[model samples]
Target: MIRHLVLFKLNEGVSRDEERVRAGVRAFQALEGEIPELSFWECAWNITDRPIAYDFAVNSAVADTDALKRYLEHPAHQAAAAQWREFATWVIADYEF
Candidate 1:
């Protein structure tokens, strides 16, 4: 399996309360069972207020690199990513397990 993790950081002057941000987060949360290539999915808002803490996170797993690619290219995922791109930046890491 492959673990695909992401940490989100709100852009300068952007607040988590903004409609765009909320919608984006919702979109991500809604993908748990929507994508066939995803074996696991979790999207969440951060509870910590520390400067080093990211504003949101996505922890997901896939069957392999090919499945991960499909998940990344899926239209739903692309749309959700587009929404997030409007208000935040993100970092991602992938590893086999």
Candidate 2:
């Protein structure tokens, strides 16, 4: 399987309480059942206030690289990402387990 990880930092002026941010969080949290390639999925807000901490995170797993590609290209995933692009920036990592 492949582990797909993403950490997101909200833009300087953005707040989690905003309607758009809340919707973005919900959109991502719903991906597990929405995407067939996702064998596992979990996402949440950060609980700590650390300088280096990201504001949100997604931890998910897929069967393999091809599955990972499909997840990335999926319509729901794309729409969520596009929305986030307006208010956040993120980094991703993928590896085999």
Candidate 3:
């Protein structure tokens, strides 16, 4: 099994408040059913006061590395990724179980 975790920090000047954060969260959560290799998915809005913390986040579990790769290259994922540029900075990850 492979657990693919990703944390996202929004671009500077972007709001990290409840409403904006929730919209980003929903955008990722909606991809769950659309991507077949996505075994499970979760999203969260960071509420910490730390100076350098991520705002949007995702944690997904896949059957294996191949499934994870498929998920990354899937068309549904590509479409979802297109909606991220406005608010997201970059993704941080861990691919090992």
Q: What lDDT does the true structure give each of the candidates? A: 0.94, 0.95, 0.75
Best by lDDT: 2
Candidate closer to the true structure by lDDT (higher is better), 1 or 2:
2
Clashes of 3: 0
Error of 3 at 74 (Å): 1.5
TM-scores, each model vs. reference: 0.97, 0.98, 0.81
lDDT of 3 by residue, 1-92 (tens): 78887778777777766475556666677888888888888777777868877776788888988898899898777766666666677665
Better of 1 and 2 by TM-score: 2
Q: What TM-score would you give candidate 2 relative to the actual structure? A: 0.98
Cα error, residue 85 of model 1, in Å, equals: 0.7
Model 2 worst lDDT run, 10 consecutive residues: 23-32
What is the Cα root-mean-square deviation between model 3 and the actual structure?
A: 2.3
Segments in model 1 whose C-alpha atoms lie over 4 Å from true places: none
- Among residues 3 or more apart in sequence or in different chains, the pairs in candidate 2 whose N, CA or C atoms overlap within 3 Å are none
Top candidate, metric TM-score = 2
**Residue 82 in model 2: lDDT:** 87
Candidate achieving higher lDDT, 2 or 3: 2
What candidate 2 gets wrong by more than 4 Å, as runs, is none
Candidate ranking (lDDT, best to worst): 2, 1, 3
Residue range 24-97, candidate 2, lDDT tens digits: 99899878799999999999999999999999999999999999999999999999898899899999999999
Model 1: clashing residue pairs? none
